[model samples]
Target: MMGVKQFPEFRSERLLDYLSTAVMVLDDHFRLMYLNPAGEVLLATSASHARGKAIRELIINADMLTEHLSAAMENGYVINQRNCRLELPDLHSLIVNCTHTPITLPGQRNGTMLELRKVEHHLRIAQEEQLITQQEATHALLRGLAHEIKNPLGGLRGAAQLLEQEIADAALKEYTRIIIGEADRLQNLMDRMLGPNDIPNMRGTNIHTILERVRELVRVEADSGLRIHQDYDPSLPELHADPDMLVQAILNIVRNAAQALEGEGEIVLRTRVQRQFNIGNRLHRLVACIQVIDNGPGIDEQLREKIFFPMITTRSDGTGLGLSIAQSLISRHQGLIECSSKPGETVFTILMPLDSKNES
Candidate 1:
């Protein structure tokens, strides 16, 4: 043992910091002794300020976690809880699989080491994959349906025009005019269902600019009662994307939010940079996250699931093509749109890769 080199304790601490799973250590009295980097990010608090705080103060419904810890401390055994809900101080809840291992100190009372691995990470990835598949399938089906409908629609409009010329009576001409008008309306609807036809002109552009353009357009359409807030990360690098398409997609989301608010609540246009983010099945080292958040009544649960599908809408006057078009546009740029809604909040997030190498 004389020549053997010992692995320093600090190296073990660093190893904890490197782990993706959140780790927290508590003393015999349940005071926080340590927090790894993942713990800080997950809890939205730094270790410097969180250390020495009572565990109950940092987590919501700490009683449930403490009950298990107390048994482990008394029995000197390890405990594992599957699918535990932990509400952080920030009010966001995460489902985690936690392990509580009681540690013994020489000639002293026992403490507990906690490891919390988020279960939502896998759940989200699976959800994204299903959503992307659904969107692609829906798009293809709609395109084929639109093409079939448009052919007869054009012929019907032409026939109506010819009939209108042949019918010298003004009364008959009015009927033909109505037919022509209806055909034109249906044609426009089918065109919208087809989504953007041109390929995206990808170029280096700032996301903030696109967001601001949408903000301004919505501000003009909406009443003064509506407020738009910008919470942007200035350090975000430019992403290679079609600014116009991004603007159109973001505008659709924002306009939908504004309409949902009924000219009242606030909408936030927020942007942030996500590191090592996944979009659909692909993973990227850097990604741009754009969020359109609104404090409205939120989308109905039944309809929220199919909000991005063609002809699915909540409003009576809505064409139902807005969100479908938006989703299609974002997909063209290799990004995906996801939504989460509750009673008081609705959020639509657009995740696009920021790395130029990821662009087509």
Candidate 2:
């Protein structure tokens, strides 16, 4: 008989390396022994640099995490936490569901295995799907309504024009003129409500070019005190999108930020590239992230939920169609816009896929 074929043993570290959830191993003394790639991403540090560092040094506010790790190691208890907040070194915050498991071998020292799964990512994906669905339904309804309304509107305008030509008295013709003018204004408003109907003229475009166009426009129109700052990733690749549509989308967001700032606060336009990002149901290898951050009074909690819906406005004189139209434009480019606000800061983030392929 032929000799039995032998296969090399699979290493646990190799398995951990492929995991999507962040995994970190610590020695009994709570010193970092190993960090998987996902863990390195979560902590924003490399395994080579982070090895042997104290957990406290890696995470700024790790008191709660420390307590759980200590319990798991000291009592051999497994601990799981949901919606735990982790503050990173760069001041970015993460909400995660984490698990702590104690490990012991026959002759090896005690250790702990920690796993972190980001909660916000999952939540954001759900929200994005819902938003897309809601917008699609709203747009369909509006299209049907527009068809019904526009037919009568055209007839009314035509009737008014005929009356204007037939009227002998100048004063009575003024009524016909008002009727025609008001009909035209309503038609324009309806068109605005419907947003862009033309198919996006897509091509390879630099995101910075679109942002700069928006910046210059806002700067020219804004007050002297309104400052716009740029924090862009210079290495971002060209995106496949419509340059004009992107300009309009970003301009709407920046203009909204300026209006919120009331011409006296700072608005920062920041860009970055995210890898292995999910938008709606598709996963892209690379996605461009654009953020319009403003230091102004935040949006109301109630309004924030419906802020993207048409006709939802916080300002007395505001039309509330700007953001809705912006959302529509970006959606056409396979992107999403999300907003978060507090008392002094509001951020509008737009995520756009860089390529057509959906990577697995």
Candidate 3:
């Protein structure tokens, strides 16, 4: 039997960079010595800034985690904790599976290797898969229904035109015109229900350009009492997408936020780059996260889940196709749209994969 070959020190470090789990090495004093890329994401800090920082400084309210690390290092024992909760400096919390193993090197002091796997990440992947399947099924059913409704609508409009020509009385012709008008309206509605038909005109595009277009249009249409703000990450790379489609998708969400605010509250458009994100079953190394946040009465819990379905609306005049169409457009670009609402805050997040080569 062949023995496994040991990787060189640099090669091992390179291998750690590709791991999905967050890995960190700490000295006996619990000061950060090494941090992988995944670790940087989890801690929300860069390796250069985090190196030599105490573990306590990086993770606020980490007494429990610190205790575990201390015991592992002192006793020279490996410890595994499931669903360990850690508080971050930004006040965000994470539920992760933590593994602490003590290690010794020839010329270096004793250290502990800490591995963190986010528990919620697994759950999110499962939920995303379910959401994608549900959306596909819903879209398929709507397309079938629209096709059936459109055929009869075309015949009804044609008959109305023919009847109008045969009628002599102007009063009776008025009724035919009304019928024709309504038939045409219904035909347009059916087309909207069917969603976009053309393939996206994909090209290298900047997300900020699309967002600015949406902001300008929304600002013009919104009431004077409503305020729109932008918090953008200028470091984001150009996204490969259809600019027009992205504009339409983002516009729909922003408009909905403005409406949710009843044209009297605040709306913020924020952008960031999320690393190692999963959309449905595929994982991308980088993703563009765009958020439309509103301070409003918020969506009712019962309607939140069905908000993306056709004809489901909270407003009396709403066609409810805005969000559905928006979702479809983002989906066409291998992205996802998610919503979360509370009494005072509502957020619509659009996640678009940025690394096409890493998608799998």
Candidate 4:
């Protein structure tokens, strides 16, 4: 043991211990090989205690997870995202979004290293980065489209009116009516698209109040057979938002949920605190999360990812702009909207950050 040089193992340990993020290094087996301090925080545990334990048992089923890593490892390098359902030992289920990116080291053969970062965290960061770019792009397009669209709309309406007066055929009038009606529809759409880019300053207001208003409106329109419930957190403070925009956002989601229920099912509006929430790729101090859930034939899987995009809808007569408008409004207020659907259940969640620095 004479002149035994110090290995970098201790130095590597120190590096993992101090890093702000949880970095776990797994071998080709997807085992719990090494968990840094930040990684332990993410899992609600410490590194010292999680050693040598099979990763599968610590969290929920890791079968889907192993595939993400294996695919990444087999390829040169891959970045994969997984929705991990973490069933903690306490019998509570917490869903975390995780990313598995392959890590290859020099002279390492068939390497597999997985990095798991919370989805909400990563999403917020992504949203932040994408917001300005998306806004600029959307704004430029909206402005240009509005001008281009409004001009054609006027010409169509004028031409339709002239045809109605000149053409003696009653059936010909039907064709003009269709053109005129479509022009008005396009005008309405342009209003929704370009009307609110500049508005009054946003204010701080009660979220439950907005939700209650939306619920009451829906319940008024709803039939006697339908049931609407409120499951709200009374302790949540007022959020910084535009009252009109907030109302519109809540109404769109609630209305969508109620319509899905179709007047004979249960629609629940729930409010809960997402202890540490992120939005627009930034970790907000605290967030107000409201879920509009319905028991009905759920949204189709193929349409889930595209639901927030403009002009996407499930209804035959729907404008396909409700969700898009609501999303734009919430985005202006620095909030987020997400939807999940399965058999007999669909949930639309909106997360809005609170303004108060100190707890009230």
Candidate 5:
């Protein structure tokens, strides 16, 4: 019989390195012993730098972690937490489900193994998919409705104009004039509802310049009491987009912010580059994150969900088509917009691809 072939001793280290969930090892004293790639990413640090550091120092809320470690060490079993919060070095918090297992070997010091996986990531992805699906359906419905209404509008306006020209009595002519003016207004509204028709004339465009143009336009329209500020990354790369469409999209958001401030608080236009970001269902290597933030009464929770839909508005004078059209324009550039608001702050973020690489 041939000698039994043994694969170079099964290496658990290799398997741990390839796992997507973060895994870490701590010595009996709760000092960091090992960290895989995923662990390093979650902690936002290199494994070499993390080694020998106390677990309490590396992660926030150490009291809970100590309990889990003690349980595993004394019980010689595994302890799993359904949901826990871990504050990473980057100052962001992740809600994770963690597992702690004690490693006890003959004639060797005991150690603990930890596995952490973020729970919010999956929830966020599902929410994004649903929003995208809803937006697409709304766009299709609006296009069909606009087309049906547009033809009748033109005929009504033309007839009113002809009637006004043929009328002799000034009083009677005024009726035709009113009809013509109202028809014209309705036609303009229909055109806006139809949203952008032209394809985005994409090219390498500077994001900051597009923002500056919007800032100037808003500055002209808003009251002098309203202050507009810019926080831009000068080194940001040019994006492939239509400059005109970008202006319209960003202007819509900024204008909304200005209006929310009621003409006094500050409105900030912030731009930054994000790496390994996700937009809708697709993942990109790099993206431009532009934010329109205001220190005003935040958006109402009831209106937040429907804010992007056509004709949804909290203000009586608002037509409510601005944000809907803005979303459509940004979607044309393979991007998406997300909003988060509270009592004193509201932020509308637009994420657009900065490069063609790693598009999923």
Candidate 6:
């Protein structure tokens, strides 16, 4: 304990001034007693602004942090939680891991040491970079496969056409023509599979309009027996995305839900506005959430989580590209797609930042 760092005087205070993890110490009662300099940095508040104030004063939900620490305080205050993101005052987001230890000062009845360490913003940045690399590799492999399959099909289609020309039997000619047509169809499918020019130049547009359009299209194309519900948030803002790509993304998820329903179940398209969502270190201005929920038998246990992966589908006659493409498009927009399913409930949640304002 001799080498351990205890609360020092002037020098310690000076050191706290230069620290950057937004470290804070709470008392046994879960009140904020002290905040170090580094803790101030991540939290965007200085010790003077927060010290001696209840943690709830600066955090919108004081209970969120206190609730976690309460058990530790009661039973010796030893907890280890890491990289947790909490919504702070004024919609600021902070990522911190905390440990609490009961600190009995000279036989004090109740006292504790709460240590919070902030994860560097770069940690999340690194993860995003890794995901982008994976995305690039996926596209490269898809392109290579498309070329491999299309090259041989061209010759097959040519051969069928030549045989058709030489065949004197009407039935044989018709068969050859069918072969060419099918080959061409496959070739076109390959082009789409390769996904050329799928995401166009992005522009700012109202998301409500796109959602309405998608709703109208779903109504027209979906089975008459199936009912589609729409709940739009009037306060939701515009999104910076290619209208075509987003439409395709939403349509794909919704269509999949509808198909899962088989036209008799209910499909709900709900939208809302959210703030202080930290995908990593960035606090979004607003996130436009489009959720596609269906009342069906729910996704299979083996496939529910894996359904977004390429070529993973429960239905026959599906290329298994729709959901994959939808996810890819949404990822490109710096958004995320999450799916969860249980008996009689399946929800696909799409979280896209409105207008790509990710700063702070």
In TM-score terms, which candidate is top? 3
List the lowest-lDDT window of 10 residues for candidate 3: 1-10
What is the per-residue lDDT of model 3 for residues 1-360, given as tens digits with 9 covering 90 to 100? 122224555565688887878999988888889999999988999999999999989998768877888899889999998998899989999999999999874476788899999999999999988888999999999999999999988999999999999999999999999999999889899999999899889889999999899999999998999998999999999998999999999999999888887779999899999897878766678899999999999999999999988899878999999999999999998899999999889999999999762332
Query: Which pairs of residues collide in candidate 6?
Result: 19-38, 20-38, 21-38, 22-38, 22-39, 23-39, 72-77
The TM-scores, one per candidate, come to 0.73, 0.81, 0.87, 0.63, 0.81, 0.67
Model 4 pairs in collision: 22-38, 22-39, 124-280, 124-281, 124-282, 125-281, 128-280
Worst 10 residues of 2 by lDDT: 1-10
Q: Against the true structure, what is every candidate's RMSD?
A: 7.0, 6.0, 4.5, 10.9, 6.5, 8.9
Candidate 5, poorest ten consecutive residues by summed lDDT: 1-10
Clash statistics: count for each candidate: 0, 0, 0, 7, 0, 7
Error of 1 at 91 (Å): 8.3
TM-score, model 1 to reference: 0.73
Candidate 3 local accuracy as lDDT? Answer: 0.90
Give the poorly placed runs of model 5, Cα more than 4 Å off: 1-38, 62-80, 89-92, 99-113, 158-173, 356-360
lDDT tens per residue, model 6, 254-312: 88877888888898888897653444334454678889899988987788656766677
Query: Lowest-scoring 10 consecutive residues by lDDT in candidate 1?
Result: 1-10
What ranges in model 2 sit over 4 Å off? 1-18, 26-34, 52-57, 60-79, 83-93, 101-112, 278-284, 314-317, 356-360
- On lDDT, the candidate that comes out on top is 3
lDDT of each residue in 87-135, candidate 2, tens digit only: 9888998999999999973368888999999998898789889989998
lDDT of 2: 0.88
